[model samples]
Target: MRVLGIDPGSRHTGYGVVDGHGNRLVHVTSGTIAVPGSLPFPERLGVIFARIDALIRQTAPHECAVEDVFMSRNAKSALILGQARGAAVVAGVQAGLPVFEYSALQIKQAVAGFGKADKEQVKQMVRTLLRVTGRLSSHAADALAVAVCHLHSRTSPLCRQVGEQR
Candidate 1:
């Protein structure tokens, strides 16, 4: 199965694609959609939506896995982040791909074997698991981690049973 993972941000939306075959995870592509802060927030969201839509058309992923909104100290920041996430999610839905969401802790646990793993630990594990070489940005790495989490989740017996009920 091919999955697209998204790490949404108002300034930069990270995207990664992973193809899972049996126990192997193959990295297809990973990048960030960066928008300058000069643009209005609504325009930024539009850019994110358009880019994600185009990416879905290009990659044809079977499903999309996204990072869910975590609580922030700043409510305004959280709201903006949620808007960015919504843009990405809407793009996935519009493209007819089933979307899955994982919390930050869930993604960290799946990738690093610890729910409280730090960013560095998750980043290193993602690189090791995906065999990605140098120069992966944090956002991209996080996005890749989300993809790996979904791959692992989908293959687990519990997830299979859950899906069966749906």
Candidate 2:
């Protein structure tokens, strides 16, 4: 199965694609969609939506895995992050892909075997799992972790809880 993973942010949304079969997972592509800070906040969301839409069309992923909004000390920041996540989710749903949401802890644990794994650990594990040699930005690594988490969860009963359809 081909899965697209998204780590959404207002300024830089990261995305990664992976193909998984049985116990094998192969990295396809990963990159960040940078939204200029000068652009209006709403316009940034439009850019995110459009880029994710284009990515779906280009990659043809069978499913999508997205990071869920985690609570932040700043309520406003959390709200904006949620909005960015919503835009990405909408893009996946519009493309008829079953969307699965994973918490940061879930993603980290699945990829690195610890819920509180540091970013460097997560990055290294993602590179190891996908057998990728190129450098991966933190955001792209997190996105790939989300996809790996989904691949791990999809065969279990947790699949029903994580897979959200709109």
Candidate 3:
């Protein structure tokens, strides 16, 4: 399965594509969609949606996975994050790809074997698992982690049972 994973942010949206085959994962592409801070929030959201829509058309991933919103002390920040996620999800669905959502803890645990793992640790684990070398942006790494989490979850017997029950 080829999966496109998203780590959404108002200023910098991250995206990663991975090809999962049995027990192996191969990195396809990863990058950040950097939107200028000067733009209005609404325009930024439009830019995000258009870019993600174009990306999905370009990559043709079979599935899309996104990291769910994390609880934030600032309500405004949380709202912005959720909007960004909404843009990504809409793009995926419009492209006819099945979209999946995973919590930050679930992504961390899948990548780093710990729910509370730090960003650096999760990045390191992502690199090691995908055999990715050289520099990797934190946001891109997090996006790849979400893709990896989906691959793991889909193959898990427990997850399959839970999903079937739903």
Candidate 4:
């Protein structure tokens, strides 16, 4: 199965595509959709949406794995991140793909074997697991990790909770 992972940010939305068979993972593409800082908020959102849409069309992923929004100390930052996440979801739905969401802790644990793994560790694990040699921004690598988490969870009954089966 092919999964598209998204790490949404107001200024830069990172995305990656991973193909999984059973428990194995293969990296397809990874990049960031960066909006100019000078652009207005609305325009930046538009840019993010367009880029995400294009990515979905290009990769044709069967599903999308998105990072769940976490409460932030800064309210403005949280709101902007939420907006970007919304746009990312729309892009997946528009491309007729099923969307999956996972918490930051879940992703870290799945990818790095620890919920508190740092960014560098997560990036390294993603690179190692996907066997990717090309350059990948940390944010994009994190997104790819999210997709990997979903793929693992889907194949392992132990990872499923009671309510998730429905």
- Tens digit per residue, CA lDDT, model 2, 1-166: 9999999999999999999998999999998999999999999999999999999999999999999899999999999999999999999998998998888898888999999999999999999999989678989998999899999987766564334453
Best candidate, lDDT-wise? 2
Cα lDDT of model 4 overall? 0.85
Q: On lDDT, who's better, 1 or 4?
A: 1
Tens-digit lDDT string for candidate 1 (66-109): 89899999999999999999999999988988888888988999
Query: For all the candidates, what are their Cα RMSDs to the real structure?
Result: 2.9, 2.0, 2.6, 2.9
Q: List the residue pairs that clash in candidate 3.
A: none
lDDT for each candidate structure? 0.90, 0.91, 0.88, 0.85
Which scores better on lDDT, 2 or 3? 2
Candidate 4 residue-wise lDDT, 1-166, digit = tens: 9988888888888898999987778999998888888999888888888898888888888888888889989998899898888888887877877787788998999999999999999999999999989788988998899889988876565443212553
Report the number of clashing residue pairs per model: 0, 0, 0, 0
Ranking by lDDT: 2, 1, 3, 4
Question: What lDDT, from 0 to 1, does candidate 3 have?
Answer: 0.88
Which has the higher lDDT value, candidate number 1 or candidate number 2?
2
Q: What is the lDDT of residue 117 in candidate 3?
A: 99
Q: For model 1, which pairs clash?
A: none
Tell me how far the alpha carbon of residue 46 in candidate 1 is from the true structure, in angstroms, after superposition: 0.5
